[model samples]
Target: MAAVTMRLSEIGQQLRAFRLESGMRADEIAARLGVSRAALYRYEKGEVIKLDTVQRLAELLKVSPLTLLGIGVEYYSRPIGFFERIRQIEEETDQILQIADPVAYLVTSPDYDRVLFQAIAETQDAASGEQYASIMAARKSAYETRRPTMITMLPEQAVERFLLRGVCEAASPSPELRDAARRVAAAEISRIVEMIEAEPIGLQFSVVSEVDNTANCMLMRGRERMVLAINPFRADTSPAASTGVSLITSAPEAVNAHQRVIEALWKDSLKGKEAADRLRLLLAEYAIR
Candidate 1:
């Protein structure tokens, strides 16, 4: 076969992700590939590697040669570029674990899907940005169609806030518009309530009475890749919102650290009927008022 032309930086990313998700230390993988630790670091830094060495790397990582030649985890500070990359990853992800705001980012039911899109459409119309409209539409469509295995950790207060105030970003908007946003928010919360009660397939839902927002993020776990995105802003309003400095790693060290944190938090959090009843009480209070 002819040698494939792949960018060192991109290939480096795949190697790192594969290494991390595989839960192997750099030294272990490097030793298996018959390279010094420093050489392995250089390879992961996008340094040139011989085609024969690429074959060794594929064997060590237990992946096809093409996998290493393809896309890898990336970090982005810019809004448009970061969101575009995230949209791509999200579309491809088979499982998602999120530390959500009032509304869950993914795993929303079909009835609530319309509400989420309406919130996005309203936010887009207010900004008058055609590009964002398309981006948000694509994101919503991807989630609706894929509906990847979903798990979320939601803050109790944030859910109450979202149910009441909604995510409309209109500046001094009309009452009817504001009402629409609230309805969207309400529906989004209702689905969570429903999920807890129904426990649909591929859905794992939970609510935590208190969650440290600083550590919250959306963690997408793919079969061969993993992305940990840190976005400070609540995503209920728009999928294209400017995420804070995000971390994308396929390295075992970092991904495992995050996994431990998620497990610890989930253990301390509320779920099943307990979480549902608490939310239901809030729902009733908000509705009756």
Candidate 2:
């Protein structure tokens, strides 16, 4: 049936995602599974997959069988894997609805990338840092080319904190890095203010006081499917990619639940001049400090 074929296709897609996250080569996985490399590639291309094979692949991939089958949540503990998954989903997305507490990385200026790299590069070796840089660049490029309709809700308290601590809050940062971080924060927030005032097509920014959460939640909607990602890994905050677990799911129930929450909070969010003025006040208050 058509329905069964579509389900297989989704499962194949999930297989590729988990494979990327696991960092295992297709030939290696195929060898372990006692299948040919060609067969593994075929499975990833939506060929028929046996239930027992799904179970074995789940074990090999370190994910639950339900997750492999697209029937349960996809868990990601590494920020690189999580963001890479997001980048993959965004490749096909036409609309993005997000609640990225302080600001969304997509709207941030280039200087923001420099600040982020400074934070990540501090803890990583040269090679790992370069890998992270590539992922960031790829994400930015995907957004530029796709130009998805994005509606983002930001928390006011989070913005205040971002202005206070800057993007990278190292345990003991040098004076120069601290100052640069604050300057980048100010510039990034000012850019948000400009966006609010401009009301650009296909982009919307709203500052909300009630949503106190710092986690990033996004619903990426494509032509045939939508994905919900709840990520604790923040690009701005520079949290270790390994420290926190993220949830990615496509179940209708979970999607509907998160949609309800977004809808409720969006009603009370401030936009246009009101939002811009609020951000300006924060900038002034922080600049005086």
Candidate 3:
């Protein structure tokens, strides 16, 4: 995550520097790219750059793609930079705020049961299953080592759909897939509710409204933060292709902005007993008694 963020930021800064050096305004660049000035601003701010756009920028700026990507000679040869940074952040986070359309499970944590993890894995494509296992194991080790605080905000409809239907309507395929998903979803939902009820490490769960288009789940660890946004193309077809970008920052302003967004969502979401009641209603609607 840190690697991704650092690279993007570096690239963004480099783009801005080059643009200024060329004595061109943002509007001029936006006009050339056929994008709005606001869109260009987002790129300059280091939000997330598309691969094609990076290529175009490299061509336009007369810089190598690797340099634009911040993949300095040494780092480019390594395969572990991205995952290693994620592990480091997990170990260091004092608190984590997770906002995801579908739930984000720390597989090794008590928050998720092993059976549920396997069930979810069964629904994945072969490659996804392999990746899931590796991620689950790594997350488990991180949880055991760090024991950071966790708060999760999920979309109300997703919870309702999963609990009432006993499966993720979005992930369903054939009848067999539906059944497998249902068993896993029900059990995982129950486990999650129970964990929240226990309030271990001040854990909290809430159902937020108006999250339909939100596909990313964020994890904030002290001065560092990571956001994993789902790849729609991957989800629709090859589960093994599930890809996301993780953003990391120690910048006070950036961290504060993310914290504020999480807090706002939390305030707008259901809380404590109210949240539990909502979960129960869904369970009853699904006949999970």
| Best candidate, TM-score | 2
Q: Which ranges in model 1 have alpha carbons more than 4 Å from their true place?
A: 1-80, 109-128, 169-172, 212-214, 238-243, 287-289
Clashes per model (N, Cα, C within 3 A):
3, 0, 1
> What lDDT is obtained when candidate 3 is compared to the true structure?
0.56
TM-score of 2: 0.84
TM-score for all models, in order of appearance: 0.65, 0.84, 0.57
* Best candidate (score: lDDT): 2
Model 1: lDDT to the true structure: 0.66
Between prediction 1 and prediction 3, the one with superior TM-score is 1
- Indicate whether candidate 1 or candidate 2 has the larger lDDT: 2
Clashing pairs in 3: 166-182
lDDT of 2 by residue, 159-246 (tens): 8888888876642456777778888888989999988888899999888875546457999998887889998877654433467788
Show the colliding residue pairs in model 2: none
Candidates ranked, most accurate by TM-score first: 2, 1, 3
Q: Write candidate 1's Cα lDDT for 96-164 as tens digits.
A: 887776666555545444544555565455442444445545676898899888888888877777767
**TM-score between candidate 3 and the true structure:** 0.57
